[model samples]
Target chain A: MLTLQKPHRHVETVIHSEVLIDCRIENLYYGDFRAIRDCDLSIERGKITAFIGPSGCGKSTVLRCMNRMNDLVQGFRIDGQIHFQGQDIYHPSVDPVAVRRHIGMVFQQPNPFAMSIYKNVAFGLKLNRVKDDIPGRVEDALRRAGLWDEVKDKLKSSALALSGGQQQRLCIARAIATEPQVLLMDEPCSALDPIATRRIEELMLQLKERYTIVIVTHNLHQAQRIADKTAFMYVDTSNSSRTGFLVEYADTHRLFNHPQQEYTLQYLRGEFS
Target chain B: MPTPAQSPHVSQSNSMVSNHSKRSPARTSPTFEVSVVSPPSTTDVLVDRGFRGLAYVFAWLTIVLVCTILYEIGGHAFPAIQEYGLSFVTQSTWDANNAQFSVLPEIWGTLSSSLLALAIATFFGVFIAIFLTQDFLTPRVERVFTTIFELLAAIPSVVYGLWGIYIVIPTIRPIATWLHEHLGTIPFFSTPLSGPGLLPASLVLSIMILPTIAAVSRDAISAVPNQLREAAYGLGATRWQVIPGVVLRTASSGIFGAMVLGLGRALGETMALAMLIGNSNQVSLSLFSPANTLAALLANNFPEAGKVEEQALMFAALILLAITLGVNMIGTVIIDRTTRRLTGGTS
Candidate 1:
């Protein structure tokens, strides 16, 4: 039987090379409202993991926990462990800024800073104190994000002049400029058109070769098309208090075709989405 | 062709025309308009016209008041300006006994003192705004502190003058003396502090303008979008880095506006400066030397002046107004240019 049980400490350490992130969330709360119940998930290295759920299911909450972005919220508390490369990210000694330096995030809306495209990409490099070969690194990041060809001619022009799809690509380039290992994308294509969406999905597929990508999306077709593994989360209202929990997680084809849990089946069948 | 209502074809065409007019108001002629029953009553028309007339008058009051003030001041200042010609603003002599008055010394005093006040106010005000708006204090504590700072502006100018004389002068005397003894080679700090002078007056002016700068700056900093701060943090920027790199950059134009407002207040301030500044009609480089701004001179000698002296004071007032207006205009232009650049505008 293939059981998704918690691995022991030594066993996890032994299998650490296979997994890039291990999220074991016991409970998460915002103020007095419980947001997420006990959940355990493992993200494979160099693969795309998609978190798919309805609104208010706390899928983005779990994604934010991976990079400790939830720490910015007031009265946000978590009682769990998210281990990145065999180290607990929430440990007292871990600096959030240092953690963020290694993990980058792309937001739902393409928020290019109110500056030039080159400066947007160089912001992270400068913050990390990358003094030497900054121009080369910025060009390299833009090329990898598939934006260099479009923006190379106007590197000094304001980023606000770019089209919506180009701006999203610029944000992606900005995030990866510092060479972060993991990229968390929260609906990166939600604000994009169909063509832009396809382009970004293709870019993500190519990016997974070098970076571990975790994405939260409401579009199930997008997950089925690009994700290697898919995790389904549902609002668990069995105990009177509503909180989200992991329902089923498996390889993309199996999760969509043969969901094991009744909730997953209902969600897939458009009965209780 | 047809007996009006007897012919079916003629009646049908007439009905069609009525239906078309009903469907489209734009197709109806002005003389054939529908009156929708009763018109407005006589009392309503009267009241409407009356209200509009009042609003028009109120709107024109500002222009009328400003023109009146300019005319009166110009008329009084004409004699002095004609007598001195261009030398009225260039030469630095104010012998009222000989009816010789030049605005050079007062112009230097006003510019130097007001500029110094603005510099000091901007330095402390920006820091105070940063402290108040950031996460260093709780919201409740921040409100209390902000209210206290606002209260500083409510204190009258004469009260500030009294405080400067009794408390501030004695307190800063020792520090001024020490600075003069140590940094004496610097011309600004060379003179020894003996009594009320330019330094005390400027200190008092800075204090008076502090609340204006602080309040406006606090509002500007608070107006910065939280998303910019979050974006900076996501890029692994520390709090200190985010402040200068994001918050200050975004709020720079508004902060400049706040400083200009403080400068305006500093230039026009009268009672406190009249009492604190040793009203001597001379220009000196040392901060400890006695000086007189145009405002202080007018306040000191306006009541007991002869006809020519009065005209001279009026001329000084006109100069003060011109300088303040020029500063405001230049400051606004600079701020506008900076904002345009920040927003990626070509001009």
Candidate 2:
């Protein structure tokens, strides 16, 4: 709702795709510990952007910042600005709940409410007062998340009764039911097995057609397989305390094949600190 | 003169390894020693049997205690039951002068007073649970409130009775009169506040059980994992939407169990109700009128009762026991099922 007009847009960004989220982060800290710094990136609309890095590289931290999820953490502070739909999400006038309604997120673990599967998907619609046909919207959202058929017959049963992978998909369905502009996923497949992981990877690819997706993944191969653009971040250990910063951002093919930085190359080649 | 003691200690430390080898026979045995796993000795068998016998005796002592109480109460109640038959419970009059007694009014008093207390306690207890569990207040303030709840539970019932007689009666008498004046047409507020009555007793009972309901509801609410909160928030839910919509719904059964437990405590409260309920053997719909519960009736008359009065009082005690015990059993079952269901696992 608030306009941040000081910074100009990054020109020639990501295949010249329309910029959906313009982020300019100078520093991020939690109670005196710096997590990430100087990470500026633009998320293109209807595109799958992957962040691949090792542990503690702030890949998840950066992803959480997109939806303002980090605001829930104690003493979490950000010297940054993020604009979505040409409005600054962190402005005092802009409510975090309203920001989340526009930008949804799925965590690393599958967290379904104890309610029935139907209620889980319909929760957001009811909260946002989507006066449209609720049952129809729930079915459509589940269908888009690729969980409808498996759950259609037992829509009234508890969501916890579903398997691990199905519950994760239900979480995805719950997130997308509100029809958010962007879906931020923080290692959505980390807790799942390989089969479940592959099915979700396919689901992500399908979902990218409608929603702009930003995923932080430790799986290099998975990112290479699905992402259209990839940003690589590495832990900056030049000082006494190591913190994460962006090393390279480009098309997935260019970043994988001919990386711009030696850190990116070493990370791709399995060389880690 | 004592210098040789240090020299002896140094010699023992120097040869500690050799001492262990000589002292421990197990060190020389094979890795698997069959003798070490041999059958129990005679002393072990005797000790085991003696311990088992003592445990069995203690277990049977509890059963015997329960049976003794049941037999004594039933024996004394036989005279009243034989004379009055089923009419004893349905009849309205309790005339010890004519050797005629009934328990309907006492039953009404017990149920109405307990339920009224439960309703009031539940209202305040649930709000206390929500405000305490949610991260709205400073943790220091939350801790202070939690300590107050525990202190409320720790206070003696007799003290509550004294407070009810001296403080609660004088305080609520005016409010009861105002309601009776404006709402006299309604049966609940029909009568004027006669000295000690159902209204004051019920208020004191609510204060007594408020801690029970609040503590149980707090545990149930907190048991809900933060993951569910995250899930709800991630779906764009505001705090108000999330509290009743998600958190309360998830812990509903547990909170119900807590109310049931509070009802159990209210049903069996004797001293406080005895002091405040006026010990009148009459029933009326007006909460301002004096009434007597089975617990207070038994507590008040048992010391001065003659033969027939004693028999009737014993009957009252039996009914009180059945209601309170049954309520407690139901509460325990509900709490067990829901806590296991709510906290089974988190995704």
Candidate 3:
């Protein structure tokens, strides 16, 4: 019953959007269902773009669409254009395996592979054949994710032994080890406590200078504190049946404070169910 | 806390209402109050009645059967036991006219052929199991292959012996000839393959035991948890890495148990060795030459042996039983140690 439709047409400049990821749009499908309809979005480089919405709003679906992670899901199909660094990701000549090597991902749950702590971070590097000086690279990734000192001595221990917070950091370390140009995190801190969430937020702030980050988060406050750009989505339940839509995307302060849409205002006021 | 009194009048009135309902007539309505009776306790019933006494009867029946066999064979061999005085096992030369027989050659032939069979079965059977369990084939193709192999296990030993004599010999003769010419310098194949011998016997026995090793090893490999495979894949480990590093290491102990079971079966095989081993009592290391296995020797010559020869045959039977039972005991120990190691690490 919450619609993110703007009351009237408005134009807001997306700074440096033409130079960043030039994403083209078409409908995306999950079998017979039209999950994302005519979605056209461009992400500015080196800035945090948070996809914010209630449950089943297709925000995460679009986020997965960005990295083509939906290929792992059975019967998932996309009819759209997603470009990374001016390359068509879905082109016939392009290999999804190679695409993943360049665009790294962190999943919703902290899924560090069942391996030694060092090997978990070194997995992508090894796959890409970045052979020499593996230990130093793994240590550097851990340090960047703020997990070095606690896990330095336990490099050979099972990654599953780490706490949930540490495991999430380890996943982040693993994603960055590939030296990817873009990082897509689908709800990175939803499983963590507030303190842990704050640590991840700080890590993200530090990482934005190096990697373009796209995060899908349900926490409005966390998004406000961390995101440079925000995309708000909601269900068009006027028929009490139709799925959802992403109605507005703008700079963080504008999206949270002064919106042109009634639904956006109600959502910001926590009045919409 | 103090108990509050409802006064005697209220208590009496409340009790009267309940009693009135309790006294309602059963003639106009169905009976709602039925008592439940608990079943008799198992222990009490068992204690009241003694065991069926069939167990005691069966136990005594087994003992009597064993005693009957011992009595029959013992009575038959008693004269030889008195005459030979334990020399029947040590002396190898058999002279029917003089009634002098020795079993040393038969014992040597039995051990070498069975051991050679075991070595071949262990090598090839384990290799086959690993190949089938890996992702070398599509799932449907793998299923067909597995079913065919499983059927191989069900083939009777006599049929295997017949096939070995009729089919396998002609097929493998070229390889045997090649080995005789090329690897004949080796002690095991130094002699020419004039006819069936220790090599043929071992090859036949290996074929008989191959199915067992493959089936058991396949079961053990399939029993490895799917989570382990997924975890390895998630680390971007290739098929080879996952198989050797995770799957095989996890299933190694179980495969070893399977191999030992196959070895035990190989040591006791009789008809196949009898048909293929040429039944010659010699201890030559050359595999191309004729030899005899303990089971084959007993099966072929026991019925014709006189009192002295028969007692020596009984000694060979006892030795074969001891070897098999010893192998089973060691297998139990190894399997126990391996299972303990696995459970200790995982749990």
Candidate 4:
């Protein structure tokens, strides 16, 4: 049995080499409230995973934990392991800025900096020391997000001029322009109309073929449409403490059609009422 | 209504008289009211016409203010101009006994001291502003420093002059001595001090203007949007890059306006200059030498002036006014241009 464990360890090494994000947590806190309690999640390489939950269920919190964007908030902290690719992300040796370069994020609101559309996409590239041929790179990013045909001639126009759905796509294009291995989206389509939302959902499907995608969403239909794997979360109000728990995580079809837990069944049957 | 000017048909007196004196008082009154209600309506015209009258008065008052200032300065300086002509600007002679009052020395002294003060104030003031705005200090500490600087500004200029006389002059003497010994090799610091000179005056002026620049600059820098800072940091730029590229660039126009305003104040300072600058009459560019500004010279000699000399002093006052007005005008223009550019509009 000890010899059998040795070969399993080597196979595990091969499996981890293919993983893009490895998250381990003892607890995550936002001012003494444990948002995600002792949760461990690994985002697979080149696959789309959807985190589905009710409001305030720590889905977005876990997504922010991946990129360390939580560091920007006051009194937000996590105790545990979060490795990007293979390196310990929270270690003193790693700079948060450098970690963020490898792990890109798209926020719920489409925040393009107050500049020209082209400049907005090129902002990250300049900071990451890619100075040559910015126009070409910007066009390429826009094309990948399928926005180039609409905005190619008007590159110098203000980003605020774009529609909500187009702006969200622009944000996605901006994030991928830096060529990050992992992309984290927090309800990327919550503010978009159906057509724009459909476009983003399609874009996510295409993007996963090249990069790992982890999305936090409240819409179950959206998860069904785009996610390969699904994580269902619920707020645990049992101890008079506001916290969230991962109720179930499995292949999307099974989680939806053949859920095991009573709570999962009741939730999927819309029987929370 | 009656024909134009033919009013007897609807006149109340006519109706009352027609009713006759034998009628009862109530009956006559009703008849009179009915007659007046229908009378020709041509009596509602009254005019004070005061606005048109006041407009001329205000226009004349404005003209008078402008002309009086020009006349007072011109009338006093006319004789000096006649006697010394343009030589007053070119030559440095200031023999009060001989009555040869050329202004080259005083002009040079004023420009050098004021410029030096502006330079020193701008450096320290902007540094303090950036420090204050960037959260370098705690809120309580920031408030204390801000209050202290503002209080320094509110202290009367006369108090600053007195402080210069008793405290600052004596305290800085040793530093001045060291500078003279060490930096005397440099042409700027070559001259030796005799009691008080341009250096002491410039130091006092710097202290006076420092609060002005700092307060205004702090306001300007604080106006930069937090979004700009976040954008820079989000791109992996450090705190240093955010300040220079985002905060400072956004606030540049406002900061420039603040500095120019401080410059105008420095140029026009009076009491401190009168107190500390040795008031010598020479056009020496040397910082260590005694010198006089137009204001200081006017303060010093106006009381003792004869008719012609008084005129000369007024001309000097006029010159001082012109310099200040010019500086302020230029500052206003630059501020206008900067704000327009920042807001993305034509000024």
Candidate 5:
């Protein structure tokens, strides 16, 4: 196993001493195609870190790597280390299923199971074999997700009957029911209207008080609105084949207003994107 | 002076009429010309009518064929039905010399054997589908196994009968004897006959229908969307957890439909059961005792039956047809209800 020492360039002055996840992705490939190259970044504990880039820039790929969700894809292999807390998650002995239990994920589309709302929220708890007070824990999670009051009377109804926004919130409740330490969202609001988008943004902001968040989005303004730290990635077309690399990483306000790299500045201004 | 007055009056009249005609062009000669054109060509009209006639004829062909078969069978069996007056189905005696016939034993045999076959097929078929469709095997290997299963269905029924008589019965006789010795307290395994009987017949029928059930079940399992699987795995479900909870639940209706289709095939089987079931006329509790199904009875007796005896056989055929149709109707209703529930009643 490769253990990476904390790199010197990590921006520690903006945050306190707690660093929850430190990612150093040397390379990621699918079959023969390289997707991400030489990417390194750190996630601050209990804060929202956003990965902002254009489409096909490997932003979602990096986010999936955090919880080892990319292992589901055939022929997907990673070459470097991803350390969660102090332990190497990519080591041979670590089971991906157990890794996912501690780090939950919400996809771009709201995919509640083909079951009732109560079952959808309780699915994770049952999988982990929780022995007592399941209904209480489910209601607590639903309340935290801002969905309990709306769906309190009809928990037995099908989840598909809910509106798009409510379904997304239900998905959030399902993810948080297990009380994972880290939450990964890959464009969680890309499928919702603006009003629903704002609600989820507020929810994410509230969730940051308890869990570390890593989000991937093509909506630059959404990243600017909620992220504490932002990482900008762009496709590297200088080589024979295109691969994505991290261009700049900084506090969200600084990266948006006064970007350090020329590419990041151009991307912010929507110049030739 | 007279010519100038006349010319002014004529020019004024002509200008007034021309302005009126321009205001109403929609009702004038241009529209009239379009309306006066000829109707569609004779060949086009004839071809359209011909195609419609052909379609009507094809649609009625199935109805006509069914009515004819029913009419012929009813006409032949009318004497037997009138004479027996439902006793044909209630009594078990089938003496050919005195022309007294009954199908009670055959009815019992057909129902018990087919139901047992269906139960066994459904149990193993669902597991096979789940195994083949899951991530346990590579796609190439899965394809090979699927092809081998399909080949089982393609073999002729007579071949299965011959194999059952030669290999399956002899091999299973010992086990049947052991079952009689150990579990004989249960009526199902009570008697120990040394030859072909209901147990071997049902086992052969189950093997024959296995491929059909497995194929349909595999299709059902594969039809479940990837999103459902992903949702389950994303919530940290193990492979075992995801299968029965998510995949099987989603495919339950389809599996039920597959079992019904296999039952239909089993109920109609003739040569295979005739060869293995020992073709006896007794209704006993022991599966080791010899028995006769309705289809096997027809196949065995239809060859040299007398006039009244042939009518009895036709009556038996009619009963078989009615039962199969009833089973299919029930299956369709259940499948419809399940599909409607799954789709939230829109279907």
Candidate 6:
């Protein structure tokens, strides 16, 4: 977590390298309306974890809670604990900005800032005041996101000029620029075409070599292709609460090939979308 | 476009208006017909055409009014233009006792004082805008402050002049005198405090125009998409960093448009400057020295002027008109451009 927190450096804390982010969300709420309940998930270091669920199942909501992105939302409150690198992210003294610095995010929409491509990618470094080889780091980040070949020549041009795919890639480059340990993507390629989605899936696979990834995807095939671990979630509409909860959590292959919970099996069998 | 529920009845032969749907039918609403659609009446076409013609005339009135003003002022100014040529503007000497007139000093005061006021207003207006938009205050409290700022514009300019005379001048006089006495070497602070001068007039002018700048800037800052703020925060930007770096940068062009619009308002300010600027005809660098603006010149000298003085004042009026119109045109263009750009025009 990057903070102006006194004498505390904003860097990666590696207490247990295996589990980078441990989330045990008892309940999440938007004002009085409870959104999610009873979800305990561990995102391992350097692996792609895909969150697969139907719409309104709080997949994106839980992904956002990992990085404290929901703090910006009005009346958003969470109960229980999400410990990132052994520190409770919801602690009173913890700075959301610091948590965000160490863990970046990519939104469903490809929203590049109203600036040049180079500047969009370099936004994190300049704001975080990272005293490094800035130009070199920018080039590396762009190349890693696989956008350098397309946008390197037009670095100074407006990011808004890029195609949807290129802009999504630019966003990914921007997220990785600050060298965050975990990257939370909420339907990042949902807005892109099939080819663009394929490219991003490949990029995510490559990115997991260095960074932890938790993605919320509606496309189950995408989870089958790229995710090492998969979490299945369903909305409980029985008690008029309409709360979403985790139904199944396991290895992607085992969950798909083997039978577990009846709800999970019914969901996999296309009983209801 | 009217729904069946809106205008429930229709007849084949009737040149009449609706008792319920008194106005012309809407063109946008397309949903929720509780019953069958009404047949089109013949008078509907007539009413629509009539409304269009009326609106056309009203639109043309703006152009007609502008042309009429231009012709009247230009005709009155012809004598002065013939006597002095365009050099009437550049020549500084204005000896009214000798029937000689030039607007160089008035031009200086108009541009310099308005610009200084704009600079001061922009500083405070931007801070006020940021405070209003950033959720520092809740929506209800923010509306209260917004209304208060806007109420500043509702006050008459002469009232501002009165306030300047009674309050603003006296409040700053001690500091003005102290600065003049100690740092008299600097031209800006060289002149001793007086009742009315450029500094006091500009301070009041800044206050007068503050609402315009603050309101427009608040709209601009508020128009910035929330997604941009999220993107910046997701990149680890603190609240302060996101403000100046992302939010301000995104809204800069709109804020510039707000300044330009405020300048248009400031440039044409007449009654206040006439009363509070002390209406002197000399150009001086000191803030405490009295000066004259083109608006003030026209306001002060027009009623009692001889033939040539009236012509010269008309010329100054034409100049002021051109300046304010040109500024408004530029401001409109800038505001339009900012809107399109922020909406993500490709170029």
Give stretches of model 3 more than 4 Å off: A1-78, A89-92, A95-97, A103-131, A141-273, B1-145, B187-189, B194-274, B277-346
Best by DockQ: 6
Provide the TM-score for each candidate, comma-separated: 0.86, 0.85, 0.61, 0.67, 0.85, 0.88
DockQ values, each candidate = 0.16, 0.20, 0.05, 0.04, 0.16, 0.28
Task: List chain A TM-scores, every candidate, in order.
Answer: 0.92, 0.93, 0.90, 0.91, 0.93, 0.94
Chain B only, TM-score of each candidate: 0.84, 0.80, 0.75, 0.78, 0.84, 0.83
Please give, for residues A1-273, the per-residue lDDT of candidate 2 as tens digits: 633221221222334498999988889999899988889999998799999987888999999888788877877999989888788888888878887887888989999988889988999888878776899989998998899999999898778888899999999999988778789998999999999999999999988867889998889899899898999987765545657888889999999999988777767876453
A169 in model 3: Cα distance from truth in Å? 5.0
Q: Each model's C-alpha lDDT? A: 0.87, 0.86, 0.75, 0.78, 0.86, 0.87
Model 2 residue A102 CA deviation (Å) reads 0.7
Residue A164 of model 2: what lDDT? 90
Q: Write the per-residue lDDT of candidate 5 for residues A75-103, one digit (tens) a residue.
A: 79999998887778898988788877878
The sequence of per-residue lDDT tens digits that candidate 2 reaches over residues B1-347 is: 01111222345556987887677866576775665566899999999999999999999999999999999999989887788788877877877788888888899999999999999999999999999998877789999989989799999999999999999999999999999999999999999997899999999999999999999999989987788888888777889999998899888888998899889899999999999998787879999999989988788777888899899888778778888888888778886776555434332
RMSD of each: 12.4, 9.8, 13.1, 18.1, 14.4, 9.6
Superposed by TM-score, candidate 6 places the C-alpha of residue B331 at a distance from the truth, in angstroms, of: 4.2
**Per-residue lDDT of B155 in model 4:** 85
- In model 5, state the lDDT of residue A40: 92
Q: lDDT per residue, candidate 6, B138-170, as tens digits?
A: 789999999999999999999999999999989
| Count of clashing residue pairs in every prediction | 0, 0, 2, 4, 0, 2
Q: Put down candidate 4 lDDT per residue, B18-104, tens digits, no spaces.
A: 687657676546666664455443443223356667888999999999899889778767888788888888887777677877888
Candidate 1 stretches with Cα past 4 Å from truth are: A1-17, A237-242, B1-60
